[model samples]
Target chain A: MSPVLRAFLIISALLLLAPLLFPSVYYYRIGVLVLINTLSVTGMVVLLGYVGLVSLGHAGFFAIGAYATAVLPAYGIPPILTILVGAIGAALVAAFIGKPILRLKGHYLAIATLGFGMLVWMVLSKEAWLTGGPDGMVVESIDVKAPFELLGIKIKTAIAWYWICAVAVVIGIVLATNLANSPAGRAMRAVHESDVAAASLGIDVARTKLTAFIISAVYASVAGSLLALFNRYVTPDTADFLHSIEIMTMTVLGGASSVYGALIGALILTSLPQMLTVFAEYENMMFGAIMILTMVLMRQGLAPAIAQLFSRGRK
Target chain B: MSEFVQFCFSGLTVGAIYASVALGFTLIYNASGVINFSQGEFVVIGGMTTAVLIASGVPIWLAAPIAIIAAVIAGMTLYKLAIEPARGAPLVTLIIITIGASIFLRGLMQTVFDKQIHRYEGFSGEQSIAIFGAALLPQSIWILGGSLVVFVLLVWFLSRTKAGNAIRATSSDILAAKLAGINTNSTMMLAFALSAATGALAGVLATPVTFTSYDAGVLMALKGFAAMMLGGVGSPAGALIGGILIGLIEAFTAGYISSDYKDAAAFLVIFLVLFFMPGGLFGMVRVERV
Candidate 1:
């Protein structure tokens, strides 16, 4: 079978067998967290892997999406509309900011994105009336739960959200995979390789980059929306600079070039903290050590580096 | 009106602290071409170590030097152990390595020092003297004057001293400097040590005014990085000028604008600077092929 078909076959099997792997409903909650992260990393693959532009502020978009869900329903908007609102809002902000920021390259670009993320964090922290300040605010349950019970046996709410998130992750993976193989993806890679070369080939360099930026923002927004719905509470810390770094760390850990690589990275990172919670106070120390070790030992990122070693041995 | 002056005075004082950190950042960047995000961790170490020693009843004079010396050794060890191994690593790798070092240091500080915040008596006591009817701490004057002195001294050292010339040569062209018989590796190590020392010194000086904790590194790093970027990352003069300007900006913004948005104002300035002055205020734009 072709690569795409093979991937689908694997995904279908995993989705079918997901319940068997879960010993209790809590694992499903963790599973949902992984899927949410996977969606965000898929967004990253489009930008860093394809377009060649790195953004430290994608968390700004993620924050906007999250805050929208927490703050909007209080304004009488329906809970489901929050995701769409968040995606549109994040995309618009990206386009506006990308206008001037996209001109810089390398460290300047990195710092500019960092500034944007900080600005978002400041707003989230300071706007106590809207965001409940650093203490965070409780969100109304997204109530997607109501529809699930009609299917007969009432599953745990975490399981229900896990399935919803898994479906969204599937859709996201398919879209990203398709986009990666499309002409746009090819153009993005060209720009990534050498913008001068891409321009020489008559690609609309700025426009292509902007499209990818906005598209990635959409992925992050969707992920953010799912996270808020699942947690039923949101806080300023969700979109803080450390969270932004955490997202980047996962992307780098899993491999920036592939969605599945991102997925694997997300899964490990999401689960690692929980597992390390058992060790208590050494949690942060272990995290710091693990992050450093991975970046140094697996500089090509975990998935691709492991794959390369495997292929080398096979040869 | 008095409150305004007091705010400005406080802002300038803290700004000098940030400038000291930014200067350290520029020193490392000039020599090694990595951002050295761990710069903040060094500062925290100085503050925490000295505070702990003082708490243990070590004489203030003896405690301060010990703190500086300890941080200097830690900085050098970081270079030898982590940075040296990744000599030819990509830029991103170097960046992440420094971040890792920072995170590791922060973790270590928490475990070793505990999570409690700390402060001690300022060198000249906690008394605030009236300046234009707004009180100014004597420690603030010490910090401000000290940073300016370091800046001027660094300029003289780089231009006039033999070792400084060697560092200049290395920063400008490492291979050429190496060919000219400068031990480029030693120069790089020295740069990290000096830079880390400056950071630690800043921490020691400012701790009484601002207090210190395990969590202070991130904010210090962010402000220092912003100052370095504003002053134009490899330029010493830019660091001084930019540091003062950012300090004033924060002061004015906090005074006039919402305190909550004071940080946002700095970031906004940085974003604008990146848009219009990508090379920075003092930096000349370099042409590199995409």
Candidate 2:
């Protein structure tokens, strides 16, 4: 079997079997969050890792997906269709802004994306009429268990959401892996190394980057949609600057260049807060320390650093 | 007309603060191409320290200088502990490191001080000075005057002093500066310290008008960054111009347009300006060698 297929099967098996070790519904909820974050971070791997473009505003897309699900349903749109609508909306927004902002390099690009993210946040928070202001709004939950019930399996809501998110994550990983191995993916990597060189080599550098941006935006949108559906609530906080940073941190912390690294990053960040509830006030401090230490000690991130260690041991 | 004057006063007051913050960014960026995201935290530290000290019965004059000293220490500590250790890392890594430092400092502040919003009495009393039908607060004058004094001092330091010349030399070319026997590392540390001091001074002056809290740094950092970008990165004059422009624009927007969208105006202006002039108003157009 191909490496992609093998990796998929392994991940699928783990997702299926991991639930057996879950102690309660709370763990399942956290599992769902991890998978959602993993899905989003996979997109980060493609954009930041593959194309070497950083976006400090992807939470804007996430918020779009979430708000679409929350508000569109009230307008008689089907809940499931909102996900598709949200993805399309996010894609269009990314494309529209990406053209002008992508021309900026480095700090400029970071700030431009940040500006866009803040604009989205402002609109969501200030337009209380549409988004229910900062208080947020309730999301109409989708019946994920309906099909399973038809099959005579009565799974709990959390378990059903967990399975659904796991399936989404698997699909997301497969697609990302496929992209990573494709000709276009090669172009992205080439751009990541040197956009000038890529351009000289006849690659449409701008087009390639926009493609990555759009794809990543779609992934974030879908992940946001899933989170909204699972939680049955949506807030403007979903698209805040801190949320964007959290997602970026997860992507970089786990090793932005690898899918498995994305998974590791999502798992650790998602669960660390829960474990640190005992020292609640110290949580941010610990997080900041971890980020600094990680970058200073292992700039390649945890996964690549660990991989190197193991390979060196073998040598 | 009076309303306009009032807006202008408020605009200039806030603009002075933003200018100080932007100057901090310019200093560090020039010395070491790292955009210090924790610049606003220096402001917070300055203000918070002053508030805490004053509350503990320290005189205002004593509290203010102590706060500035604390911020300078924090700045040097950040460079030595976080930034220096990550030397030669990628730009993205440096950015994250600074952001991490900001978060760490914010957490430290939250732990060390209470989360309540705090501010000391303005250097002058709370009386409003009436000018052309507008009520101008005495604190605004202090903020404006204080910022000007800091700016003058900074310019004199950069242009007239030996250490300032060393910083300029390092900024122009690190290798060349080192070849000429300048300590680039120490210059960088000095840049960080000066940047922190500028930000802290702004905080000390403006806290009386805007108030201060642990979370206030985030918005200040964002606005300061916007000002830096607006004026053009790495240019002190640009930072000053951009910050004043941003403050004026925000004040006018709040006065005429929806107050809720006042913050949005700065970003919208940035978008428009970047599209037309990527180099900013005073920034030199960059030419890539490659």
Candidate 3:
């Protein structure tokens, strides 16, 4: 099977199997979070992993998704439709803002995105009339629990959300995997390696980057929407610069270039705090230390390196 | 007019802090092209350590230098352990590493010193002085004085000292500087140490006003970065000047516009500057080399 097909199969297998092996339903709920983060970071892989662009502020997209759902209920849109609106809003804003800013590379791009993220954060925190302000806003829960009840087996809200998130993750992975294999992905690689070479190949370097950014924004938005619905609440932290950096960290720590890398990265990061709760207060320290070490030791990220080690062992 | 004077003092005080932080950022960027995002952590570490020490019965004067010394060590450790190993990695990797280092430092500090807001008595007492009809805290004067002293000392060292010339040479062209028998690695260590010390000094001075916490590093880093960019990358003078400009803008925006939008003004200025003048205010745009 092709890499894309292989990736899809692998994702499906894990999503379907993880629920069965869970010690309790809480693991699945946490797994749902990992899956959601996996979707977000996979989106970032298109920008940071493939194109070699670094955005310090993708939480803007996340917040947009969150707020779209939060704000749209007054308009009487169902929770389901609100997600689509959020994704589209994120994409449009990304494309519009990205058109001007994407031309700059390195630190300049990073700062621009940082500003954009901060701008969104400041707005969300200050605009009490619209956002419910810094107090945080609640969303109308997506009513997906009805389906499990009809099947005559009651599933925990976490489990149902986990399945929903898992499906979303699979779709995001499939889309990103296909994009990475297409000519466009090649063009992105070309740009990433050398913009001059990419331009020489008749690729619109600017446009390619903008496209990646928009798509990545969509992924983040969807993840944000899912997170808001999952928790039934949203805060400006959803789009804070630090949160943006954390997402990018997930993308890099998991292996920026691989779809499965995103999954592994998300899973490790999401589960790390819970696992390392023995030193609960020091969890962030551990998270930070692991991130730095990962960059220093395994630039390819944890998943790919482990895979490499195992594959070598098999050989 | 009184409001303007007060704003200027406030601007100058905050600007001095920004300048110090920005200068620290410039030093690391000058040594190794990586803009260590953890530069702000140096400030946090300094302020937090000082707070801890003072609370533990150390004099504010002694605790301040000790905090700075600790920051220096943290900077060198970050370089030797995390940064040097990742030399020649893509800029993105470098960025992530620094960011990770910063996050790690923040986490470590929180563990070491619990997450609590900290404040200390100002160096020159809590009295406000009348300057041009505006009542200003004496700490503001110390902030202004400290900033000037640091910048002047830095200039003198760079222009008049052998080590300073070695640093300048290395920054202008690393390979040529190496060919000239300069130990670039030691210079890098020196750069990190110096920047960390400056950051610590700023933290020591400003903690009275701003308070200190592990999370404070994020905004401090962003403001310092905006200052650095405004002053042009790799220029200490630019960092200082850019920092003051940013502070003044913040003060003015808070005075005239929504106080909540003060952060927004600094970012907006940075965006506009980078968009229009990529070389920054003092940085020369290098002819593109493909």
Report the number of the highest-TM-score candidate: 2
lDDT (Cα, tens digit) per residue for candidate 2, span A1-315: 875796699779989998898999989999999999998899888988888888888899899999999999999999999999999999999999888777767676676777788889999999999999999999987889997899999989899899889999999998998898899999999988887899999999889999999999999999999999888998899998778878888887898888878888999988888767744557556667777887888777777887788999999
Candidate 1 ranges with C-alpha deviation above 4 Å: A1-6, A145-154, A278-280, A309-315
lDDT string for model 1 (B1-290, tens) is: 89889888988998898899889988888888888878998999999999999999998889888988888987898888778778877665676667667777888899899899999999999889997899999999989988988888878977898888888888888889999999988888888888888898998998999999987887788788788878887888888878888888988888887787776666776776777776778877767634
lDDT of 1 at B7: 84
Q: Kindly indicate the candidate among 1 and 2 with the higher DockQ.
A: 2
**iRMSD (Å), candidate 2:** 1.8
Clashing pairs in 2: none
Docking class of 3: medium
Clashing pairs in 1: none
For candidate 1, give the lDDT of residue A92: 96
Superposition error at A71 for model 3 (Å) = 1.6
User: In model 3, which runs have C-alpha deviations exceeding 4 angstroms?
Assistant: A147-154
Q: List the RMSD of every prediction in angstroms.
A: 2.4, 1.7, 1.8
Assign candidate 1 its CAPRI class. acceptable
Those runs of model 2 whose alpha carbons end farther than 4 Å from true positions after fitting are: A1-3, A309-315
> Which has the better lDDT: candidate 2, or candidate 3?
2
Predictions' DockQ, in order: 0.48, 0.63, 0.65
